[model samples]
Structures are given as C-alpha cells and as structure tokens.
Target: MKSILFRFLLLYFALQVIPLDIHYYADVFSLPGSHLGYRGLFVLAHYTPRFFGSTPSFADWLVVAALALIGSFVWQRRQPQPDWDRWRYWVTAIVRYRLAIGLLAYGFIKLYPLQAPFPSLSNLNTPYGDFTRWKLFGMSLGIVPSYESFLGGVEIVAALLLLYRKTASIGALVIVFFTGNVFMSNLAYEGGEYVYSAYLVSLALFVLSYDAYRLFSLLVLRQPTAPNTWRLALSRPYLRWGAKAAVILVFVILYGVSAQRGYRHDPYQVPGGKGIVTGFYNVSLFRIGRDTLPYSAMDSIRWTNVVFERWPTISIAANRAAHIDASNTEAITAVSNLDKTYESQGTNGRSYYDYSFDTASHVLRLTNKDPRLGYDTLTLRYDRPDSTRIVLSGLSPSHDSLYVVLDRVDKKYLLEEAAHSGRNNHQLKL
Candidate 1:
C-alpha cells in the first residue's frame, strides 16, 4: 500500500506538471480560458463559481476533496525511512526550487509592462463597475491609480523571499496569505472566473505544505544527515525534453480545439463591420394642447408619437423637427404668443448630420452635430433604407433650435454662427 501510494503521488505530480491536454478536464469542469500553462488549473478553480454559481458544484468539491484525502492517506501509510539526505535534497529541489521559480516567473509576468492588453489592467474600473459606479470607489486604486504595479511589487517581494531557501517557509506563508486574499476577491467580485491571482495562491499553498513538512522533520526531529546520495533528478536532460514535449502537445491540442470552435482571431473588432453605426433613434416632439399654461405646465401633455427619419436629407429634417419641438410649444398653446425658431448648418452643401450606414445591421448614425448646438453627440437610427425617416426621443443640452441650420466651416464660422443665433459665446441660451 505504501509503495502504491508513493508511486501514485509521483504520477500525480508528473501528470500535473507535464504539459498536456489535461486542460480538457478544465473544460469539463467549466473553467475559463487561461494564458499560463498548468497555472490555468488554479485559475479555473477560482473562476468555477462564475459559471457554476456562487457555490461550487458538489462534484467539483468532491473530486478535489477525494484526491486530497487519498493522497494524504497514502502519504501517512509510508514507513518512516531514515534517509535524511535524500529527503532533504528532494525537499529543497522539488519543493523549494520549483516553487521559487514558478513564483518568480509569475511575478515577472505580472510586472511585465507589455500586459497592457489584459482586460483587468486595461479597464480597471470595470470590475468595480459591476458592484457600483466607479466614481463611488473614492480612490482610483482599482483603476487609474496603478494598482497593477502595487500587486506586481508584492509578487516580486514574495518571489525573492522564496528563492532564498532560508526564508522560503516565510515566503511561502506570505504568498499563501496574499494569494488567499486574491482568491477571495476574485470569488466575491469577479463572478467566479478563475483569475491569475487564484493560480498564484494554489501554487503557494502547495509549496508551503511541502516546505513546512521538511522544516518540521529537520528542525523538530533533530535528525542527522543520512548517507542516501540520490542527487536531485530535476536537471536531467530527459526531464527537460519531456517537459518541452508536453508543452508543445498541450498547445497543439488547445489550438486544434479553438479552431474547431470557430473562435475569432480577434473578438474585439466591432461586429458587422468597422466605420458602421446602427441602432434605433427615437424622435419625440412635445406640443401644447388646448391650454394657456406655461411651457413647464405643458409637461402634462403627452409627447407626440415618435417620427421615423433617415440620414443626410432625413437628418436635416429630423434636426429641424427637434428644433421645432423645443420652440413650438407656444404655437400649440392657445394663450402663449411666443414664436419659435429652427436652423441647421453643414459642410459644403452636405447636411450637418450624415450617416455611415453599417451594412450588416442596416443602421445609420449621425456623424456630425449642427454647429449651432456646439459640440454634442447626436445619434440617429434608420430601421430600413426605404423607411425614409428616423426618430428622436430626446436631445442633449448642447442642442439648440435657433442655430440648427448654420454652417460652421471653421472656428471663426462656429463663433459667428453662435453670435448670430442669439447665444452668447460663453453660454448657449435658448
């Protein structure tokens, strides 16, 4: 039983450390994608809850717990051999050296300035955005304040400690604590996706347990070195070859699977096509009913049905309609005698608002705003090409009815239009 357990432990390590398509198991377990090699397993463990739910699936926990129990039982059943030298060498090289290297590599990767492409680092506030608006966080630690640099520093320090065997135990403990924090954070806020931090934690825990055992046996037992002269087998050429082969095989498998799935070469590109805009534009007009009340009191009157409009020619009409909506309340009112104005501006002979219709979605968005409204976003949508018209549900505060038809060819043109439209250069007053 002892021999079988020892062999099983060795085989488990070989399987885990060897680069293979063992990641297929992660897919079965519903793990997220990872860039790092076997470290992906730990990432999967951290992120499992995102796909599975807040709680781990019973099967996942059961499998891990079972493996741990079996391994523990096997380890305990082994007879105590007084091969002190052999044990020490194995503990130092296999447990300490491997762990130190792994941690250092992980730290280096995190510290690598080229990691700007990562989503977490790119949009730091997005994660917090899930819980609350980013503005509520007070400090920009998670977003713009460079928290990635801070975390990288922590990893570097921990890695350095682990490399020095004397401080390895302490280093391992610190890593565990740090990684544990990351795991908890990922679980709590990351929607259960196994993040890179979780992988670091698992590696730390494994190293910690292995190193602690050796520390206990060496110091507490006061064992003298024995004559077991087995050198560390890690540096053997065959092992290096095997590790390389494993990595290549895993990559091949992953690539093949990805290809079969029809994964995109780049998923970030806008769908349909570039330089195309599409979506609905709802244009709502407010009119006064048979009432002599103020414009504010006209709020009780329901807005008119949204009018569908189009771009370029139709966009000009929509802007004119928006201006009328803002200014014509008195015209519809029975008592108010105030008159309203509407204007528009464009470049050359083109309308200020033009469409770059997206072929895929058949959507058009206004590219330019009327200069009279100053700088503002004006979006419009067309359901179909033949649909002759677009709709406007609302206008941004920058929009004005009086200057909708002014052409601002340059800054000077803009200022002249502003002045002519009865708006002060500093303030856009209707």
Candidate 2:
C-alpha cells in the first residue's frame, strides 16, 4: 500500500518538474545567444507565459492532479502492493537527481548575483512609495550580493549532499525548510515563483517521508528506531561512479563556470548603469521655440527636473500627468530590458524616455519608454560644461526648437551610505 502510494506521489512530482522547469535541461551547457542552452530558455519563455497572476494557476494544478489520479487508478492495484524496501533505492535515486538538478540551477544563478542584481541607478533615483512590493523585496536582496551568494551556497550544499545515499534525507530536509520560506516570501512580496517554489517544497517533503517515521521516533517520541532503507550492492561500481562523476562535472563545475560568464557579460536582471552616468539634475533653464520660459508648476511645455538612469532610461518631471503601471509579476526571460519593465515604477507621473547617446555627434535621440502613451521623438545636441552641468539644444517632442541647461544635484542615498558604513559603534548620518 505504501509503495503504491509513493509511486503515485513520485509521478505527480515528475509531471510538475518536467513541464515547469526549463532550467532542468538548459543549465547543462555554455551559451552565446545561439547556444542550445539559450535556445531552451528562449523556447520556454514564449511557450510558458506564466499564468496571468500566478504560475501554475488553479486550472493548471487541476489538470496535473487529474492526470495523477488517472495514472494511479490504472496501476493494477489487485496484483497486491509490493514491499516498499524493494524499490526504495530506485525511488531515492530519482529524487536525488531531480533535486540536485533543480537546486543546482537556482544555486548557480544566485551564486553569481545575476538573479537579483545590485539596484540600478534608476531604481535608486525613484521614489520609495512608487515601487511595487515585489520590486522592493527584490531590490532589497540586490543590495547585498553577498547575502544572495550565501543563499545560493546553501542550495548548492543541498544539491551536493543529495547526490549521496546517506546524506539525501538531510538535503531533502534542507529544501523543505529553505524553499518553504522562498514560497512564503513570494506570497508576501507578490512574487511570481510561488507555484514552482511550492512544488519543490512538496517534492522535498515526499523524499523526507522515507525517514519520517524513524526521525519521529528518534527525536519526537524518544524511541529506538531501526534503519531499514535497503540498498543494492555496488556490483556495477564503474557505471554508478561514472554517472556520479559526470553529474558533478557537468552540473557543478561546467554549469557554475558558464553561469558566471553569463553574469559577467549579460546578467539576466535589470542592468545597473548601461555604461551611462546617473544623477538627478535641475533644469535651470528651459526654452521652447527660441522663447525662454519661466519655471512654473503649471507649465507642461517647460521641463523642471530630470533624472538620468545608469540604464538606458531617463524621466522628466513637469506639470504632466503620467500613467503608471501597477503590475507586479516579474519576467525571468527577456528580449529587452524594457520588456521586464522594472524602470516603469513612478513613471506615470513623469515623461519617461529611453535614450541612445551618440558620443561622436553629441546627440541624444530619445524615445518614449511608456507603453500606454506615445510622443513625438525628441532629438537634441548635448554638451557637458563640466561633470556637474549639461546643456541641450534641439527639437522638442512637440516639434519646437528647444534649449535647456541641467545642473547636477549633489546627492547622497541613505541605502548607499548604510552599505558603506561598518556596523560597530559608528553613527549613521543621512
């Protein structure tokens, strides 16, 4: 009876992991854009558009549950349930590899700080109230790359331990506790990985059940417990050790190295500065159609303040009423940074633009970044008087000849200051 039930549970988890996790197979190879690994991720991104609000939405879960039931019903129950010990070794091997693969994929991403990158220059400039709860949580982790690395290290430790017979239970237990928190965090932060995280948690629990009764008696009820998890002899030692060696080589060393390369060159998160300077500037002077305009709160035709991101984005604050996007789901795969839409927070109240600078021509060709609205293109010639001042002259989005002077504000962020300070008897100054 126990064996039959366990078999059904195993099948259920297999379905869950096989369909949802692209990383199961993608992390095994190195990448450029055309590489097999990148292709796999690309395919999954398009095919598996995460459910509107939740991954594996209620309808998805219902489909998988129904399949598990039908599979269980057709398993020939009248033939009598087999002894659990006879197949426990095979069951454990399946769980070990599955957990190892999943954990290693997540571990390497975090290990390199690509999963939650350091907050970009734009994020720093944005108002705190404008950020979504999920963005806030993610940016909080992004600040301390070291902490993210530690989290990755923990997952990798579990993956390594799960590869062995004696330590598999311990690894499963770690996943249960660690991923349980991850699932809960996703819930609290309005994150999108809740279903996948919960699936891992469930798989870990199933694996732990092998030793659950023994652990309960040993620790909880304080009774003697026997270790009866039977195993096959090491007769095919070459085949067994060879397989283990290959897994370590490919998943641990090769995959780790490849992931690090991706992190260095094309990290999967919102970029920090896109090689541009970031700052808040005062629009000290504004002219429309060759006529100088006084700075007024109600003047939409004149710029007042602007924030330049380290990324490819900038925002101009004026008397404009902008539309803000309120969605919180994070996209893991992207064709462009704009697709992820992380920089859109607090943008609705301002005119947000993404720009490409031509250093040779001193030109700024700006395009409206907001999807809800469009504006005429703005083309301007720019000159830096010094590191602290910029001058622009060109055509406005309204097709008027324009001139502006921007003075960089001397600014300091509390978060950056906190990160730089030591946690001793030192006082924190804002």
Candidate 3:
C-alpha cells in the first residue's frame, strides 16, 4: 500500500513536471476575436473554433484530460484495501509543510521592497493595466486607489497565517480566495495565456485540494483518533524530526526543479515596459503594452484606452464608434470631445495619452486630446526619411500643428511644425 501510494505521488509530480504546451494548444484551438468565456477550464476544453481549423493539439489535451481523470479517480472512491492510517498521515503532513513553504514564498514575493518604481499606467499599455483599473461587473469602479499596498497587506497576512499551523487553514482559505480572484481576472482580461492566471489558479487549487483532503481525513474520517504503528513512530521525537526534515528536503528539491522550469518557460519577465513598440491597449486605469501586434489592434486599443477609462459615459459612444474607422472617425471624434472638455476645465497643459501601433501603416499613433494640437493625429514614423529619428507628422488646417520629432537613436528631440519648411519651423531644436 505504501509503495502504491508513493508511486501515485511520483506519477502526479511527474505529470506536473512535464512541459505540456497547454498555451500552444489554447492558441491553436481558440476562437479568433472572441473572449474565451469566464471559466478557465471550460475555455481550455471547448472554445476552439472549428471553422478556422483551430483545435486543441492532441498531446496537450490528452495530458491534461488524463491527469484530471486520474485525479478524479483518486478522489472519487476509496481503495478497497485502503490503508488510510499510513497514507493519510504521511499525505497530510507533507501537504501541511508544503503549504507552509508556498505561503512563505508568496508572502516574500509580495512584500519585497519596491526596488523599481511602480510602472506608470501611461507607459504600461497592456491587458495587465486592467489590474490597475478598478471595475465591478462591466462598469468602471474608479481608479484603483492604492491597490499595490492593499494587495501587499493581504498577502502578508495570508503568508503569516500559513506559516503557523494554528492559523494555516484560515490562511490557505484566504490565499485560495485572493489568488482565485486574480486568476479569474487574468483570464477575463486575456492576460498571458501561458503564465498568467492559469498558473496561479493551478497552484491555489492544489493547495486547496490538499488542505481540504487533510481536513476531511482529520475531522470527518477521524483518522487522527485511530491507532497505527506509523502513528506511534510519528509520536516519537526522533521520528518526528526525521519526517519533518525529509518533507522539507523533498519540497526544496521539487521547488528548485519547478523554479528552473518556470524561468526557462517564461519569455516575458514582469510584462510591462517600454521597448520596441508593437502593441498597446488599456483597461480602466491599467494598460497593456505588448511586443507583438494583434490583428485586432484598433478595436483592442480603443477599448482599452477610451472605452474602459470613461466606461458607461462612453459606453454608447463606443457602440456607435466600433463600426466606424478608428483612426479617421471614432478616434477623431473622441479626441475632439476630450480636447474640448479639458480645455474648458483649464487643464489643457498637462495631458495623458495612450499610443498604439497602426497595423496598416506600421506607424505608432498618439491618442491624446491635447488642446495645443486640437486632437489631430500625431504619427510617429520610425526610420522615416532618416534612420536616427522618428519623424512626427500631423494634419491640421491652421498653423500646421507642432511636432516634436524625437531622435531616440541620437537621444535628441527636434521640435518643428508639420507642414512648414526651413529652419524657422524648427522652433526649439534640441
């Protein structure tokens, strides 16, 4: 019985260790342009579009399905020759210790001092920005006031609870809920399909399952009250110490292996930063900037910046704007309104802008409603007419709109007017 249980555990760990390409399968199977519904598992199983030849890769699907089946088998019915006494005790002890370690690690990660400044949402235009953006249901929930500190506090408390056995269960419960929320949100926002919410959800579920199983065995099954030889050994000081040490060593090795694989598998570390600009999107206050442009850049960008920021106030506006050409109509109209409003309120000087790539022209366009430019298009054509600078161009009826062509390659900004010629238009050459 001990050998069989050990083998089962080995098999389970091996399955986890295997680098199954679930994300690849998800991409291949996903319905193009559709949000993979609310449930993560459901999306994995059924959301693939058949028409586009999108279907789950056989190997990945098989692996996940098989593991789930095996887990169900283990959980559903008791073994005929159930040695609950020995197996239950060992499993419970191992799980408790692992939970402790996991909690401590999580706490440290969250509580670590901010060596780097918090990423500005203006700079970080991605789905992750949605996390910074507060929302309840579909409506805007206001700018997330002090989210980092609040979440950090919760993580600290949860970690503390998990470290002590007396409070560990409660801590696990809290972590389960909190991480679960993050996981769901990640899925909802279509964060990274590979390493985002799904990974956290899996870890949370594992902890929840192990803790719940032990709790059931201890309280309902009343396994602790039952007598056995292993229990007698466990009661001894030397054996107890040995068991704890063994558990710690095993977990340390497992964690090391997992960490190595995680580092190798993850291509993007942290997910937000300015670099070779490819894509940008914003939600609420959070923004996502990706290095790869998606086919739906226009809709995605508009939804992230304008729709999510203003929400219901612009909900009807967004609906009407969706069918229109984003660059020409929707974008122009929205920026015009924003410029008028801001100028009227005497807040014209300072502006917040979200820029994203234009897939058609391969140009980066600024989406700001500044009064100075009258909400005109600001096109950043990289390597245009020169390799050292990005040429900024704009179309306006009056005064030819100001352009600050920043030469990122040379670390200089050449300020000029769009349509004007000669050195006079270079107002503040720097």
Largest TM-score belongs to which candidate? 2
Residue 24 of model 1 has an lDDT of: 36
Best by lDDT: 2
Query: What's the lDDT for residue 34 in model 3?
Result: 39
lDDT at 206 for candidate 1?
A: 58
List where candidate 2 sits over 4 angstroms from the true fold.
1-7, 20-54, 77-88, 233-239, 272-276, 290-304, 318-332, 335-341, 345-353, 368-377, 421-430
lDDT of 3 by residue, 1-430 (tens): 5545544553443344343445536543554443211112113322211222223223443455567557645753555455545654555444444444444333322233121113222222223322322122111211222344356457657655644445656676787778777657645643222232234344445445545766778889988743222442445678766755554453333333433343333111122223333222222221123222222434433222222122101110111121111110000011122332211111111234444555567565655544455555445443344543343444322334433233322111121121134444456573
Q: What is residue 90's positional error in candidate 3, in angstroms?
A: 3.1
TM-score against truth, every candidate: 0.38, 0.81, 0.35
Per-residue lDDT for 89-124 in model 2, tens only?
Answer: 665676677777778878887888877777755567
Give per-model CA RMSD.
Answer: 17.5, 4.9, 16.9
Local distance difference test, candidate 3: 0.37
How much lDDT does candidate 1 score? 0.37
Local error of candidate 1 at 48, Å?
Answer: 8.1
User: What tens-digit string does per-residue lDDT give for candidate 1 at 252-317?
Assistant: 334223322321221110111233222222223332233222223124233212211221212221
